[model samples]
Target: MHLNRFDDLAADVSRGLARRTSRRSFTSKVGVWLFGAVAAPLLLPVARGRAEDRYAGEEGDPRSCDYWRYCATNGYLCECCGGSANECPPGTTMSALSWIGTCRNPADGKNYLISYNDCCGTAQCNRCSCSRHESETPVYRAGTANDIHWCSANESTAINCTVAVVLGAAEDEV
Candidate 1:
């Protein structure tokens, strides 16, 4: 009988402590609660994602930043396919290209095709960058056979998606 009474008392005490602990979890504890509040923003996103996203394409230009490597909405530097974009071999272009209806010239009415140099990484410095443009005169024309190009964001193409039905997004103006 005495042993049963002791057991009952022990169980009651255990239940009370459990209830108190649960209730206390949400309370405003001084150092711990305030520290957690301060650290929440930094921890929330990290808790949501796994570790692979941070180093997806590290093999190619380890510094390059992309969707998988950096946090969403945060901007970071990224690498592209080659040396300076415009200076790419013969067929490559140094600009990112979007479809335009028969590319038109902003300086004059004459239409010509072009694309955006979304990337550049070579002697030419034609990488898609914060500002993309080329001066009429080459900055470093060392020899007569020099090949170079500049990354241009304003460039566009005349390829119409509805008509040709090929790859690439619809014409984007800008």
Candidate 2:
């Protein structure tokens, strides 16, 4: 009645376009999701800790998370194992599994290590450092209840520690 012949052609073209796009972009969709897995954390401008778990001072003993001490350059902290770079963060030079790239202090040529918290470990669930929306700071798990929260204590300039090394020590980096 009203040029129905072209209607079917238009419908066919629409389906064809959809099918082509789906097939061609299948991997890209998957890759984007995969890339987001790690990109979320690395892209953080400044990995800020939660207010509930904020370090007041060296209260519990040797303050574990030293902000001023490590003073990460590339948004990374330094976690050492028995004062050895080998036992430090995964990418640190001192770590035996020094698979990570090397980065030295701009002021001191001495090699430093980028620290890493056990975001995924046995004690706690794998905290996805990714997010769909941007927030003011990074979120961490820190409650004495069943769900425990902890981060990698790196070498920092802080004279005192708010927390102590309870996990992932030199002998325990297995």
Best candidate (score: lDDT):
1
Question: What is candidate 1's lDDT per residue for 1-174, written digit by digit as tens?
Answer: 377754453344334323222212222122123334444454335423422332222211212221111111011122332322112333333344322122233223333332322232223322222221221123253111112232333243211110101123224442
The positional error of residue 135 in candidate 1, measured at the CA in angstroms, is: 25
Task: Put down candidate 2 lDDT per residue, 24-141, tens digits, no spaces.
Answer: 2333233333333534353222223311222232111111222222221111122222221112332322211111112232223333333322211112211111111111122241
Compute each candidate's TM-score over C-alphas: 0.16, 0.17
Per-residue error for 140 in candidate 1, Å, reads 20
| lDDT of every predicted structure (CA atoms) | 0.26, 0.24
Error of 1 at 37 (Å): 7.4
For model 1, how big is the CA root-mean-square deviation? 23.8
